[model samples]
Target chain A: MTTYYLEYLKLKKKLRSWLGPIIVFILIMVAYPLTVEFLEKDLEKGFYSLLWISILLSMMFSTEDIFLEDFNDGTLEQIIISSSSFPFMIAKKIFIYWIMIGLPISALSFLFSLGITKDLNLSLFVIFLAMISSYIFLNLFVFGSALSLNKGSVLGALITMPIALPVLIVLGKSIIALQFGINYLELLLLLLGCLSIIISTVPFIVSYVIKAHLE
Target chain B: MWGLFFTPEDFVQGNSYRIIYLHVPASFLSQSLYAAMAIASVIYLVWRVKLAAYLIISIAPIGAIVTFIALFSGSVWGIPTWGTWWQWDARITSTLILFIMYLGLISLHASFSNYEKADKLLSWLVIVGFVNIPIIKKSVDWWSTLHQSASITLTDKPSIDPSMLYPLIGSIIGFFGLIICLVILSSYVQILKRESTKSWLKDYV
Candidate 1:
């Protein structure tokens, strides 16, 4: 268990490599909102547009981290052979990822949401939804990157995007509902339920794929 | 087979509800075929059964085709009732999503070269994909605007009329029979492709 904590620290130390994808993705996040404004000519459109693009871009970037270093260096093989509980350990790594990558982006999205919705309550919901949505994307990315470890980012996007679309629609609908003062609890619960289901299952899938590829 | 020819027509829908004979069966197999793929995947992962892996490989394209059939029939049925070829309704959207996921599985399976590693990855894809079934099933009941509530469930008494219900039952059975035949044919060819040098193929090849 503590070993996973050490793995998390080593992963964070590798952030310098991610700087490129992060900067580029953040630029996209900021730029996409401008397009939304051009259509509606409304600044508030920035909030929802930012949240959606940011969550997706964050996912696209962070997923690159899932198997890159370990697989590239042959460390993943040794780790898999040593640990009987690879999936749980990987789950911990995902949690740490959510903390490092997902949390900051969620916070940024919340600030943007506040600018668009102009409602503190809805913005906060945006933050909460951002976090859970990121968690979903991260887990799905873990699955995608494991399969596409050598296949490149296009395959990763191809694999995860279709699976993530339904979840995205649910989250987007709830956010839009919140903006309109519609009751959102049902949608919120549904989103959370789907999140929990993804949480419990995806790690095991990733672990099996990782082990298989390592072998 | 008897029910297909014998069922009474819906008063409002006239003969168009007849599409349900094809639509409902395709939808049922589309969803169940996914479950079968997931189960085959689970069996392959746990046991490393080559046959189960073949099931996973063969099941995907079949699942995709059935998903397409369901969508096609639903859209055909939709044109008369909804006055549009496609509506962004919840049930309809989820089914489209389901079809795309099946396509993802096929693409992912095709991308890899190593049969052994591919089997594991394929199983992983199907098992992870099992999550979509419930979302698709409940989408209509959860949101009320478009697509009507499901008229039949395994446990609940079907809300459908008996005259109409019997044909649906026959169509579902017939569809399953057809799918089973197709699966057997595909799996046999796949095995031959993979095991062409084996002694078992001496008899057939």
Candidate 2:
């Protein structure tokens, strides 16, 4: 609880970190319409694909300095020696990032969906889909961020991008299923299951990875 | 050459199917080598065996080359049989992902100067990436794909004719033998480079 609040406050101080991804998301959303020649229906067609990719890119950017700050300040070493469970701290840190960056991106996904598709039900579903998918991407890129701690996030993002491609495939399929009046819930449930597994394991793996870096 | 030139052409596809001899073996070895690396990763992580670590790095480039051959040859075979070079089918896409993984593994290791840290990180990535292997194996069954399912299975009788089947098995074994030699040669180079500062390595070389 204390750790959670501390992480939240610490991240809260860094306005650029959280606000930057939202701006990136907004830019990507706003830019898509300009790139297309003012075709409303065509803009609708490609909106969700751009939405998902933009969220992924923003999440990648958000985590670019996730561990680097603490690592550079020797704070990570202090936490490691503090007798606290290191993985728990890492997991809590990811949760705060989700609250800050991922939550807003998901909310914007709803507005963009409604603005473009103008379908209330589909936009609502987009909100839920974006919420879960964004969290999953956050956890994944955090793991990537941990792996390439000293190296820049590009290498980290490059290596983990393949793992995230399947999630994008699922997101594409789910949207199609929803449009066709099919059972998209199964796909949503699949993402939920995937999120559960990744949430439990990534922090544990990342703790060891960061420890390896410090060694 | 025996499998390519001498084997009887299929009744339907004819001479175009000859590439199967190379494609099947390369495809088989590509997946097989990753399974081997995953096992080596497990061994290295659990037992901390330096040789297991060495094997993982040694197998990575060879795996990448073989996976490329599999993709290229599979593409060549696709032109005649599937009427296109690529279809984004599950098997093909997953194999392409596998090829990317090999390169990712190699590059990930190269980014780090510390060999020990690189090996540990590589082992974890290999294990996580192993989830794709079973998907690639069962992709045809899982999805309605254009690619064919395995004609050869350990428990089931072979669906292919004996004449084609025999040479296919022979070529797979032949490829396996060739890959083993490459792994040995690669491992030797890995050992020499990693252990270059050691007195034993100096004397042995």
Candidate 3:
């Protein structure tokens, strides 16, 4: 457990060093609002809509970092050789990656929501759901990135996103509903079910693929 | 078997219904091709079998062609029966998505110059996208969707008339044979391309 936290901290440091989170924040938090404001007169629908869209794109941008850098730098091999279990290491890396990427994006999304909808509670709900969905998505993305370690970035995203579509659709719809103040309990449940599946299954999938790639 | 080949005397659509021969088979082969891709992807992921990658690349274009035929014929059939060029029926929509997945695989494979990376990426996509096929197939049945139910199956006789069934089965067999031939031929080409740098490919190339 302590090891996992330490590994998580190390990953967070690496992500910060890579400057991915900073660029993603600027793209989602700052640039998105400016674009929406420029596009529409009302800026209400445009603001809320672009906020979610920015979150999705930012998640995608960070996914490429999942395995590529480690594969390139040979740190992945070192982690595999470490006393720490490989699956645990992978879970830590994914968790940290999701935290660094999803957390800030979700925070910005909440602020964006406040700016657009002007309802703090609803904004928090939207951010909460988005954060959960993004966590599941990042796990699946990490699994795919590991499996397709040899594949190029664009192809990897294409492969992963289709499988991840159900989750994304449910999340997107729920966020839309939340913004509109509609009851979206069913969509929320569906997204939660998907998140549960990812949590339980993704580690095994990642481990199996990593082992296969090593061989 | 002799009677099976003979056309029914009381046929309504006439010999042009014979196109069902081509259409049905193409549909069957397309589904089979997707199934094969799914299975190959699983094996590749599980066992890291390079041959599965070759099989995926070989079958994808053929699958795309089969899917195209299915949509084209369905549109043609729709014109006569549904009084329109196309409808957003469950079967059509699902099949369209399947076609998109195939196109996705083809484009993904072509995007990469490195053959090895292309194989890995496409295999992953194939595995992931194949999960949606069953969902697409049952979406109509599960929901009050517009698509028609499946035609032929193990426990059930086909819903269509005998006049339609015979040619449909014949075309299906022919299409299967043709697709098999194409897969084998293309797989040979793939082998040649990949192994061409080898001394053995030198003999063939």
Candidate 4:
């Protein structure tokens, strides 16, 4: 418990790490309408695609240095020496990131969806989808960040982005489901199922990856 | 060789259908090679088999080339059959994703100069990226894509005629044998390069 709090405070101090993604998300959402005409329908047409991609890009940006700071400072090495389970710390770190970064992006996605599509019900559903997907993306990108710990984040993004493509496909389908009022729950449940698997496995795998880096 | 002259041409696709002999084996081997790499990765990660690590990188380039062949031949086959080269169908798109993944694995390994660290990271990436395999396999069934579902299966009677099926089976076996030989050769190079410092390698070479 104290570890989670401490990690939370630690991340809270790194303002750029948490706040940058939200600002980027806002910039993307705000900038997108300019490229299209003044028509509301035209704006709605590209909104979800832009929304999901912005969320993906934002998550990737946010995790670019998830482990780098600690790694350079020998904090990770110390954590490994301590008796605490490394994977648990990783999961908690990701959870705090979700609270700090993902939750806000998801909420903003809801606001963006509501503003553009003018559909409150659909916007409400977008919130849930965004929240689940952002968490999933955060976990995957954190794994990427771990893989390319000393190397730049671009290599990490290159390798991890393909794995996330399927999730993007699912997110696109979920939006269609929302628009049509069919099987939306099933799709949401599918995302949840994926989140369950990823959330459980990534931290453990990342521990080994970080260990490889340390070695 | 027998698939070229012996098998009768399809009435629908005519001569263009002959490309199937090349396309099927390449596509089949592409996925199979990744599956093999994934298994090797598992072995390496779990048991720390140095040979398994060698096998993973050895198989990556061959897998990429084979995947590219599958995509190119599929495009050629599609032009005549579907009246277009690419349709972004599930199978084709997933296979393209597979090709990119092969490149990604190779690049990830190359980015790190340390071979051992590279091997460990590459293995984990291979294992994680294995999720795309089943998606490629079942894409036609999972979605109403332009690509057709499998005509051949172990569980059911083969939908293809005996004449075409036999030659295709022969060609797939021949192609797979050739790929295995290539993989063996590649592994030899990997072992030679990575193990140059070891005394046993000097004796073996």
Candidate 5:
């Protein structure tokens, strides 16, 4: 537990360095819906879609830094050699990623929803599911980003997007369902299932790739 | 499988419908190749196996070609059956995305001079992208997509009649064989390119 806290602190410190600009970006994303709403009041659905789109794109942008810095600074090498297991280290990094990127973006999503749709209840639920699902999505993204650390960022984006299409589709559908007040339990279940699978599989894959690259 | 390949059949649309033989197998082989690449990627990542990277890269182009054939033939088949060139059906969209993913892999490889970096990156991409293939395959079932239902299953006999089955199975096997040959040939080229010294390459040049 002490070790976990230490790891968390280390990640939090690293993340704090990037938090300011990221927060400003989240604010901009949140304000997008207000602008769209002002431009066309009836464009509510479009505003909602745009909100999710911005969140997705913002997350993608923030994730580019996931491994690029580590790879450049040789920190990744040290992490691999640390007494802490590779998976634990990666999990901690992903946890930091979630806190820094996913949580703020989700909050922005909720704020955008309220601005556009003016329904606090549905907006909150939508944000809840979006946050949960995006955590899983970012897990997969960071895993891929870690894999592609030596590759350029654009290449990482290309490789990760298609793999992420299903998640996107499900998230979109669930959001739509939420808007319409329909039951989205099945979609949530599917997202959770996918999240579980990636969580189980990704650490091993990341460690393996890192080891392979080091050699 | 061989027994299923021995029967004969005719399509109501005549010989053109025979394209089904190519289309079905090409689609199947493409998906299987991606699946194999995914597994190879997993092995590479899990074991740090260099061989798996070679296998993944070798398979990408062949998978791209197979996906192309599947989409082209599906488009042709659509013109006859659905009276249009294309539909935003689940199967078509998924296959298109699959093709795009393959191209993405190919482009990533080409974009990098650092082979080691490219291999590691592509391997990771392959594993991550693999999650989509299953979803694509099952999309027709999971969503109200306008794609045809899956024809082959183990628990149930194929929905395709025995008449159509023989040629379909034969074409599938033949396509698989052809893809294997193509991949092996390409892999040899990659190996030579990667391992040969400048003098060795110059000798050939």
Candidate 6:
């Protein structure tokens, strides 16, 4: 358990290096959404734009180096062969990466859409939407990282986008529905369903990919 | 072939509906090709069969192009009928995402470039991607059924008239045949390229 906690701390230290990029990326995410305020006057589009920008940017930051640093330093080999289970370590990595990346995006989701989304209550809803999206995206990006982690961030973002699309579609509608004052409880449950499926299925796949690649 | 020429124009869709000839068959190939890739990928992963891995490697682009045709024809049909270039209509969006997946697969395949680990990694992607197909199909149905309130939305109609039905079935069969032939031919070329150094090449080439 100390090893797990120690591993978590190492992940935190690795993640701290990402803080500079995360803040810069978050700034771009915030500014880009507001820039679209004039181009698209619809409140829903505004919220959607902000949501996707944060996701895309955060994914780039989170996934690009998710595995590359470890692989380069050869720590990945040690992690794989350790007495600790590999998936446990990967799950922990993903959890910390989400905290460093997703939290800020979700937090700033509303501030980014100040003039566009308009209502404070709905902006809070945007925060909720952003959180679920980032959770789903972090997993998708983690999966993508396993594939192209040695490649650049551009490919990392590219590979993750398609697997991430369903959530984007499902949540886009749910958030749009929320904006219209419609009850989106059903859609929220559907999003939760997607999150659970990704959570359950992707880690195993990631572990397999890493093992296959590393071996 | 008969379906393409002999089918009569419809009262509503007229000539525009004919794109269904391409659309339905392409859609059929989309699902079947993915099924093939998934099966081949599973065989390769479990048994470590090189041929199965090569089959997936060879088949990904063909499947991706076939998916593109379905999306294009569907989009063409939609423009006149749905009065929009793109509709977030569940089926269209879901298929577009599938097409994106195919593109991603192709991109991933290109990056590895015959590395020893390439086959295994690609196989995992194929198997993982197959999970999305049924989910996308069902999610579309569920979303539409929940929202439509009335059971009979224009898009949810259960039956097609015979004139449309027979040709669609014919076109689907025809397209399937074409894809099979194409895959076989491509597999032959793939084998030749991959196995060119083998002394067995003297037997045929």
Mind giving the per-residue lDDT tens digits that candidate 2 earns over B93-193?
Answer: 99999999899899999999999999998998888788778878988897789999999999999999999999999999999999999999999999999
CA displacement after TM-score superposition, residue A208 of candidate 2 (Å): 0.4
- Top DockQ prediction, candidate number: 4
Instruction: Give the lDDT of residue A144 in candidate 1.
Output: 87
Off by over 4 Å in 2: none
Clashes of 4: 0
Candidate 3 displacement at residue A130 in angstroms: 1.6
DockQ for each of the predicted structures, in order?
Answer: 0.50, 0.62, 0.26, 0.79, 0.52, 0.53
lDDT string for model 6 (B69-126, tens) is 9888877888887776677766666677788778887788778765447777778777
* Model 6 chain A: worst 10 consecutive residues (lDDT sum): A37-46
Candidate 3: pairs in clash: B25-B172, B90-B147
What does candidate 2's lDDT look like per residue over A12-69, in tens digits? 9998888998899999999899999788889888888898999999999899889998
- Candidate 3's C-alpha runs over 4 A off are A1-53, A107-125, A147-152, A172-187, A207-215, B1-28, B44-53, B71-97, B103-125, B142-146, B151-159, B191-205
TM-score of predicted structure 1 = 0.87
Report the C-alpha lDDT of model 4 over B36-134, residue by residue, as the tens digit: 999999999999999999999999999999999999999999998999999988899999999999999998999989999999999999999998999
Q: Write the per-residue lDDT of candidate 4 for residues A91-203, one digit (tens) a residue.
A: 99999999999999988998889888989999999999999999999999998888899999878987888899889989999998878878888889999999999999999
Where does model 5 exceed 4 Å of error?
A1-42, A179-182, A200-204, B1-16, B42-52, B111-117, B195-205
Pick out the ten consecutive residues of candidate 5 chain A with the lowest summed lDDT.
A16-25
Displacement of residue A41 (Cα, Å) in model 1 is: 9.1
Candidate with top TM-score is 4
TM-score of chain B of each: 0.94, 0.98, 0.86, 0.98, 0.87, 0.88
- Fnat (0 to 1) per candidate: 0.55, 0.35, 0.23, 0.68, 0.81, 0.52
**Candidate 1 vs candidate 3: which has greater lDDT?**
1
Off by over 4 Å in 6: A1-17, A32-45, A110-121, B83-88, B135-158, B197-205
CA displacement after TM-score superposition, residue A125 of candidate 5 (Å)? 1.3
What's the residue-level lDDT of B192 in candidate 5?
A: 74
Chain A (candidate 6) TM-score to true chain A: 0.84
Ordered list by TM-score, greatest first: 4, 2, 1, 6, 5, 3
TM-score of each candidate?
0.87, 0.95, 0.72, 0.97, 0.81, 0.85
Clashing pairs in 6: none
> In terms of DockQ, which candidate is stronger, 1 or 3?
1
